[model samples]
Target: MKRNVRLVVARLRQRLTAAGNPGLFQALRDGAAEGRSTGRHRRVD
Candidate 1:
């Protein structure tokens, strides 16, 4: 079940990416990178 879910998600992501939704993909990738950077984002003023 878990593997199937992962496959489905991966396929969906690929289709969206192929569709040239760069802004949306970038938003998601940015959020993931931020989480990896510090578990969260730093404050900005």
Candidate 2:
């Protein structure tokens, strides 16, 4: 399951790069960082 998540993130990174949307990609990174710092985990489902 963890591996699958990693794969999805990797694919997203690639697509974001290919699309030339650094700002959006950085936002995602920042959001993830914020979640980690706040010790909060959001469920997708």
Candidate 3:
């Protein structure tokens, strides 16, 4: 669980392309922001 969070944070950082930006942190704070679900078929939103 810890590793996954770290990886997600890393990817968020990599995708972040603004100077002195902190969008990634905000996104992380907003739980269930975006990600793939591991289960039966289902439509999000």
What are the RMSDs of all candidates, in order? 4.6, 4.7, 5.9
The CA lDDT at 45 in model 1 is 25
lDDT value, residue 13 of candidate 3: 68
Cα error, residue 35 of model 3, in Å, equals 21
In candidate 3, which residue ranges exceed 4 Å CA deviation? Answer: 18-45
Ranking by TM-score: 2, 1, 3
Question: Using TM-score as the measure, which candidate wins?
Answer: 2
In the predicted model 3, the residue pairs found to clash are: none
Per-residue CA lDDT of model 2 for 23-42, tens digit only, reads 78777877787778887554
Q: lDDT (CA) for every model shown? A: 0.69, 0.78, 0.55
lDDT winner: 2
Q: State every prediction's TM-score relative to the real structure.
A: 0.47, 0.69, 0.36
Model 1 C-alpha lDDT per residue in residues 1-45, reported as the tens digit of each score: 768967875776798789988677667657757767888743222
lDDT of 1: 0.69
**Model 1: what TM-score?**
0.47
Candidate 3's error at 27, in angstroms? 9.9
lDDT string for model 3 (1-45, tens) is 778977887777666735445764565444344434443233343
The lDDT-based order of candidates, best leading, equals 2, 1, 3
